[model samples]
Target: MEKDLLKTPIEFLKGVGPAKADLLKTEMHIFTFGDLLTLFPFRYIDRSKFYKVSEIQSAAAEVQIKGKITSIEEVGQPRKKRLVAQFEDSSGRVELVWFKGAQWIRKSLQIGTEYVLFGKPNFFKGKYSFPHPELEKAEDFVKSPMGGLQPVYPSTEKLTNKNLNARGIAKLTKALLPQLKGVIHENLPVRLLEHYKWPSRQDALFQVHFPTSIEALELARKRLKFEEFYFIQLSLLLQKDRQTVQTKGHSFDVVGERFNTFYAEHLPFELTGAQKRVLKDIRKDTRSGHHMNRLVQGDVGSGKTVVALLSMLIAADNGYQSCMMAPTEILAQQHYNGLSELLEGTSTRIALLTGSTKTARRKEIHADLLNGQIDILVGTHALIEPVVQFRNLGLAVIDEQHRFGVAQRAKLWKKNAVPPHILIMTATPIPRTLAMSLYGDLDVSVIDELPPGRKPIKTVHRYDSNRLQVFGFMKEQIALGRQCYVVYPLIEESKSMDYKDLEDGYESICREFKRPDYNVSIVHGRMKPDDKDYEMQRFAKGETQIMVATTVIEVGVNVPNASVMVIESAERFGLSQLHQLRGRVGRGADQSFCILMTGQKLSNDARTRLETMVRTNDGFEIADVDLQLRGPGDLMGTRQSGMLDLKIADLAKDGQLLQLARREAEGALKEDPRLQKPEHAATKQFFIQKHKGKVQWSQIS
Candidate 1:
């Protein structure tokens, strides 16, 4: 009976009529009682303290006051009118003003009756007033159930216009809570609840919405957050278990000639301990006989490519072809070039395929790939097209994994009979907390250290006024036979403005550097693929002294001779993007520098981003700051699986809670892999209901 009531539409609630219910559904996505119940407050007010009219200060925040409505009148012109009431307590008098619902408020308000007014106090014309104050009869206010803390639910202007503001939503929640008394069954086992000393599920729901005190609110928040993370981790871990048990992967047990030769003869530098550890994890996964789906997270220039190439070599030794996919043509070509250089002495056959590939070349590459003659294939999205088939493809490496959608990545799985050992590579370091929640299903391996002999890039912030000095520095670097990259921001939302900026910057660079002494190549998204590649190759081959471009060079322009990166209007870029742009330099040993150029005026967030870029080169540290500034949603592109849409659990602040929840979830799954135990019945039922109709993208990763 309680479950049915919880599922009932919001219109059936006491204070929500059909119109209000429709508004709630459209504005807040509150369709049923369950949705409304889970619409937790963003903040709360302390109603236990009330100030007298005389005690209210002009600078005071939201305040509650006790007073009597001595007089009321309508003022101002039609459609611009407001109702004002002069209210007096024993000490002083203040005005209560209403602009929106004046007529209804004036009709309901009783003069000479004591009432409680709650709102932010605004001071104007040498007087203090409460605008659109929440008015309640003194007697009713005393008898009200919401006494200690007042929940402030999230609201919209449309909802506020329809009298469904935070207070209105709170009223609806208050009325609906009683109906959930017996309905909020415990999804977690009693043993777990007792072990954590947590409140009952029903009690937590009530306290979270209308807590009696701060202590109760904290406990309630913890319990709910744990439940959210626990269930998500449980679901992800379950998917991982199922994949391990059911999916069969080709065993690349023998690390034969190619891998050993590359390690002993072709490796340009010694592998860092972190890289070695990650490679070990990858090797273990590939040979476990279960489909390998692993994510390798490393800072930019952390040698993730070498690890991926070695993994591919292992697949080649196992007599299976491997393929690497990048999001852009430039990156694909760069990978192909780098891998080709590494395997120059070996007999390994590698091919590059992209939209820019000639028709004849693509046909040759396609035929070779199908006949198992191609040891490894590297390309952009073209690799996933149906025309591209692989003979016993054993390993698949994806760079910048977040740039591809789940469906796009899933296409690679269909390229072979059994899905290849999937390896996802990313230069953007993900915080451990976010990784657990975002890519929880995949086994994660991080290359935490950069390869030896790589010097940390020096970063500094400069205002636009310092442009001449920056240019001189660039010239000095160029005079030393090193190249420079001048990058302009290219935000998609304002492409025209960005394009103008890029054009203006490029022109200025050409005029300042001059043609004869300094040759500059420009690249942007609007450039033809061939033109962009030509410019990129010019920069790569040292034919161009300076490369003026947009974020197109952000991923894959490899120039060891390029040592200076000047990001124009650096404040316009994000933390991760700034780190990536800085990464473009510092690839070589010659003391690279990243100069962040910004305008004098900077917003606090923009300042933080620039400051963070100047502070450290640790990608994970920068990523954590990025998460705090831009939030989890924007940091991880919006196309992610819906798991990060957490209702109450904040990935930024609740790291410890997430860790605890993950450990508990792992323990639970270890005890009952299928969640079929009698003690786990509630958890299993809740997990199924929660995840119903959700596409499992874990398999693709």
Candidate 2:
């Protein structure tokens, strides 16, 4: 057996020709013999236990029995047809049914022949039956010596139609296993393997697909999962090591008058302990003279913006320029306005260079930037344009950095002779396990606490039937000089549908609140930029008591007086979006409230989301639940990261395993960073071979 043989094209396999190979690749992504071997079963059926028909009492459990067919018949019309066979054992009789594949089943069945049947028993209308049961002649049944679990591979209808169902796949795997006897070799170091007490690569692979016992199955799973995650962590940590050792960065060594003045006199609120700790971490990175690649994660309204501003102030104090890039124009504008207001009396020159900026203003800002006059620049993707040059750009603060593509962010690296220190911020909370994998290269800072004097936004769930009560509560809050937001989800995902919903909601608010006493503003994504800005401005200025809008206002809307948020059809929104929408109102000093309204009928996920929102204001907890609801791939959109190309390891359930793998990888790298030692050579070669062309490790943020 040779290692190269495992890399053979799947089409050349005994049971798989070109057609079946193509189907396997298209349906299950099994392209090579290696892939076919690694396609582990999703579940298994126990072949050891056989029960008599009369002994079965509950449909809750599945059972296998040996029985003889007494009679076979086809019943009902063509639309709702079924093939029924009366099966009898020593004590009693039961009906075996098939609603599909009846023709093949009928041809295969032999009356009065003892056969083995496996399926879940169902007591329907007081009659015992087994639906779509698996059957085979007793003589043909292959018995496992240990009564082990029979693997059930995943297959699609297209493959099943071609005689490549779960059983068919298992047969192909059995055929491939003999060829892989000594071909599979150990990749990890002997010491590391012994420390973890993991099975060999060959043993793990063999046991994973065809386990002789439950313990063997679990051991195989653990070994494979560790291998997958360990390599990912090793790759990431190695990238980080390279970046830290090789990359030179500009140092903001001084916290001069600019920073001191802002903190002493101009700071609007006291920073939370978490914010201070993060700021300290940033300060250390800047002073360390290493290209600071840091990710700042915080929940909404956690004062991440203030930390970013102060970090920029430090750059400005040290005669360097700083820029903050946001994902959206609205968010950019909000940052510009907020920072400008924060630095009102200070001489820090901040410029906004969004797409909406006039040509003349843009030219002036660009010139000012190059001349080193503008201390801070804030904008959207426009900041990445070639024309937007900076004189002495030292630091970049990217808000919601995930919204930008790798190419777009990479452009900023080339803007300076030495890549500027980067501080990426995200209000969306990421689970710790996900963060370790997704953002392993960059150091992470977390601002987990909200600022002092800010009250937790009281969140509540409501049904459509309680709309009037919610509206009354809003009126009461409005009477106390606080503003309210009435948000509605789109009838469908289209902007037109969203606009229509906003319009209808606006009309209803007008009819309910009525006249000159209560003013309302409406904003949606479909509206013109100017029009949306006008409505947003009106709402921010407190000219309107209530603003009806879509999720366009989910980010960067800071109105201190807005204290109530009424979200219509909140069940349609994800947990993160709902949290962000709720964050829009709690900026004010008053006790803010968020009312989530949905129909009586809600899905289990929706119910969990709403209940989580209502139960606790902890964004991290909500994010964890969201990760469980939607796995790591969808949670952070990490499918593109290649770190999530896991076959068995689940980010949600395997956090402990991930931590262990990362720690072990970190320890291994610390011992031999380049894997130059003889024992580590195989591991290094295996990693290089596995990830050679598939991943761009440097592309990870």
Candidate 3:
């Protein structure tokens, strides 16, 4: 814990010094001893034994061979400095050669000498030569020294240039193992360690760095992986227990019959089965004695807003105030308009409050909200202002859940005597296992089905070579009097990147649709707020025939008449994001289409992404494929890995483990709520170490 406890260069750590420390820091991002301790290898290389050319397949990537040097020869110019030292083992002979670093290679290598040469033995010009391989003296090259496994740290380009590549990381690990203090002697309880047969902290660190065998490494990993899930679960359960202890609420007993009545009598549309089930779930939670912490997840245009509205109405019917906070002003306004129109015949007073509201108008709205005159208030993050108080806030529905931090979302709970029941909505669908791991404190409801009458967006993949042909299709769609959208990756390319910039794309579009009468508007991340708003307003009003922009328009924008979406370099987007962009077009009554434009040259993964877009309109199915393709962290938006975090325990590969872990965690928490007793001591210690005694991060991340 002491930052300056050790200030020695890595090379001085019994095996490293100034030069090696510089190499390690510049190459591996390792500076402090702590950094070296946590600098986990990406993989483990098996250097357990030596192999011969005859013993290895011709297609083997690499193989280490123990042999005696049969001969040595010099070839190439002085600058090239090539040297070949042929080695012969019982199975066959392989030549160890060096080209550029021959000066060191020649000093380390000799003819008629036994040595250990580690490299791929290959036939180049009718003979074998290792470009540059690891060579050790015959005496020091004890087969047991490398007879088991090798750690392969993540290396960088700088590492390669510094000649501190994979082997360098391995060397650093070997040298630092003795210096590593097992901060934990037996952090986990003895029972758990014995039950799981997990390695001790000291054993794990050593086995992971230099394992005796693959089985030991597997045991070491299991020890750490179990700790990651255990701590995460313990922290979540402790927080949940802490909150449940201080109960807040005058529980609403309404069976949500009013909503069903309103729907049956005045409903012009039908509620999907998923929506009804979700509404029932929320009603049960709200009516129960406990406060509700619920998340509603749905695909874009899956009618999540309507679900939120119904929940708010249940609160309003019970004479309690409810507020829905949208991340964007446009979405807030949309909610206001829809609710105001829906509850027109009811006594539920509703109003819209946003940052753009006049000072005079805001003052009146604030007065109304505080007096409980407004039963339903809709606004942006402006609703969180200390000045805006709700008399009896019973429900807080947040749209686009990820936009707001947990601290901000919790603000609404403090607004009233009884902390408001929370309903969070997200257009971005989450894989169920991820939703559970991340949102364990809350209940989740998913709307996997789109509403009836909404058409699936037809998708097609296009290459730049077919740009002119695509332009023809766009013109044809425009001739139908419907609007179109062309989304670009970014406003401009980065310094290193040479992709088509948005401004460049905009200019080209103008050149193609050159008629002065044609209306084309550009929107991107760099534009001023007012300018962006104006462009969006124009596009929404049908005043602009084409909206060429970035992913900024993917969320909170509603345009019904737009029938075509063209996403440039569609390979650059995540599957969820691409699906959200496509959702923009299908709102119209007319048949809509999404055209994905990717580069002519595509990798297998990129091709799979494009093909997935062309194959299905179901977001859940696409999401399942996405999880299979990109792992949970990438799909969920961040990557972190450990006992406190994780380096592996991949959610995609071990999804079943997550399920079992969740079930085990829930059962454990129910039995040992406080986690204070000796039996739960290990779980308690795990969370305490993870949060440093702060339970909040566990509740959120």
lDDT of 2: 0.88
What candidate 2 gets wrong by more than 4 Å, as runs, is 1-3, 143-147, 491-493, 638-640, 694-701
Q: Tens digit of lDDT per residue, candidate 3, span 1-701?
A: 32242334455565556776787777666676656766776687677666776776653567777778877778887777688877788877766777766666577667777777777656676666676777776678674454567777788777666666777667766776665563434556566678778888678867877788889998987776665565666655555555544465557777455565667665557889999899889888888778788889888878788888788878876777888999888688878887777776765678898989999999999898878788888999999999998888888888886777767877887898778888889887777766666776677888877788888889999999899988889889888898889998742446223234777888888988876656898886667878988999899898888998888888756889999999998988878888889988898678999999988888888888889999998887788778888876676543122212455566656666666666667777677665556866755655555566444544322
Provide the lDDT at 59 for model 3.
37
lDDT for 590 (candidate 1) = 90
**What's the distance in Å from true for residue 207, model 2?**
0.6
Please state every model's RMSD to the true fold in angstroms: 2.9, 2.3, 4.4
Error of 3 at 428 (Å): 1.6
Estimate, for each residue in 600-630, the C-alpha lDDT of model 1 and write its tens digit: 9999999999988889999999999998887
Candidates' TM-scores? 0.94, 0.96, 0.85
Top of the candidates by lDDT: 1
TM-score ranking from best to worst?
2, 1, 3
- lDDT score at residue 515, model 1, on the 0-100 scale: 75
- Across residues 419-521, which tens digit of lDDT does each residue of candidate 2 receive? 8899999999988988888898889999999888889999999898998998899889888999999998864547676677778888989999997889989
Per-candidate Cα lDDT values, in order, are: 0.89, 0.88, 0.75
As for lDDT, the candidate ahead, 1 or 3, is: 1
